[model samples]
Target: MLKNIVLLSILMLSSCSTDRKVSDKVSIMLDVPVSPIKTYFKEHFDFESFIAIETTDSFLVSDIKKIVRSDDNILLLSGNRSVFLIDAHSGKLKVCIDKCGNGPGESKRIIDIAFNEELGQILLYNDFYKLLVFDLKGDFLSEVKVGEMYENVTCRRGEVLFYNKLNGYSCYPYMLKIYNLKNKTWRTVGDDIKIDFPIRSRGLQMVNSKRVWFNAPLDYKLYCFEDDTPAAHYRLDISMAKLSDDLIKKSISDPQTFFNEVSMGKIVYSLNSLRETENFLIFHSNQT
Candidate 1:
């Protein structure tokens, strides 16, 4: 069963405004149809047999929390503060990191994990507020202290991008905390705008191998960083439903009531998740 899965509709916008001076605002009107929920199951999915990984004393898995694929290895994070590297094809355990202590090369809590294929390294973010580095063979190399706590972390081009919220008026300028692995320093990116409410911001997203994209949770504008500065990309407009400032403020105060109202079709909720590709921008709405 797919839990908390959102069905998204992809929309491709025509024409690209590349002129540095041209306004980067594109309005799109969507006429979404309201339909009832339905379920369907097919019997034959290539008639494949399932191969289960046996749980033994050496390969004990207790509640697999997250799985990340890197080449031929499958990295599984467990709820018991352990990380296991398994072979993707043979379903065999390669190495497991289960050291849960304050000693060196150990972590009390694993917040997140990312793999760098180019460097052949595994980056682990832990509750100690540090980023631990290990090779593909599960050997600890080094660890770096991070400045702030982040909910999401991603690495690209030798730089680690951390996404988290800042305390202050919503008008603060930037939210991204970028740490340079080579220079051993940190910096911020994105534009300063009114943050009317305290909400989770979707931080840096990798557009390609080098570029990263960003967008505010409350705003309809999409931005991409060009040399560490945010440049306007596109804007979305919904014709069937509109969100007003009053509704947004209410959502900040009482999210449960706001979601209840959105479920009842009283207001069109804000865009939850936004994703983009070379040609199209995809997103889902709260309206069923």
Candidate 2:
């Protein structure tokens, strides 16, 4: 009788284990619906109608490519190889830097521009791997030899922030570098992330005067730096519209196939250009 009881107990235990396994499998196979994420934009801000500013006779811009805002002036980069500093309010031409030759303070192609308030200088980057410094009055200050061609550049607190294309390939993880005008030294940052593909244009912006923000061309997250150190800050979440990892890999490897799939409305892609303000973070993406 005892032996019979022992066999019966073993059978009961096995039956219970089988039931638990079946229950777990059912739970794993259950379908759950995810809630959609909601985004809100501020609508309390006031809006003003546009008023066109007439171009003065002194300020002759052939084709304005880009404009940067200074204290009370606007720096206009024209396609005709000219840089004009004009008053923002009066529409008067303050100064124009149009030195297009193979000599000093001359640039074949202007890549980017920055303003240094403390030194009262304007920094212009050229295609020939040169950083030309000029006074606010359009006088040539000095020229520094840059190692590689940079697509975008900005200056703040006497330091120039730019990404060196040569270093991006050689230095796998470090893509952004800072050049100090005080000591004339280069320091690398952005070491936490690694980019597999070569980025032609990097997104680097100075938020006010103290912090700097950057985002890779293909990345969804934005990074910020305060005094040369990464700060704990905000992150963007578009997982609701993000593509699968397999699809992202395929897109990078086989762009033609990815484009075809996107054209057929089979894939969803996220934003590339990211910008932020005190109240809002703006980006553009494609949805189907």
Q: TM-score per candidate, in order?
A: 0.65, 0.68
Candidate 1 residue-wise lDDT at 3 = 20
For model 2, the superposed segments whose C-alpha errors exceed 4 Å read 1-64, 164-174, 192-194, 198-210, 239-241, 244-253, 260-275, 284-288
Please, what is the whole-model Cα lDDT of each candidate in the order they appear? 0.58, 0.56
TM-score of 1: 0.65
Off by over 4 Å in 1: 1-67, 166-174, 192-211, 225-227, 239-241, 266-280, 284-288
Clashing pairs in 1: 170-195, 173-192
Clashes of each: 2, 0
Instruction: Give per-residue CA lDDT, model 1, range 139-202, as digits (tens).
Output: 9999988845655566777777765444443433235567777677777665334465554433
Candidate no. 2 TM-score: 0.68
Kindly list the per-residue Cα lDDT of model 2 for residues 135-231, writing each as its tens digit. Answer: 8789998988886765567777888877535444322222456688777777665553444443233223223222455444344444455646534
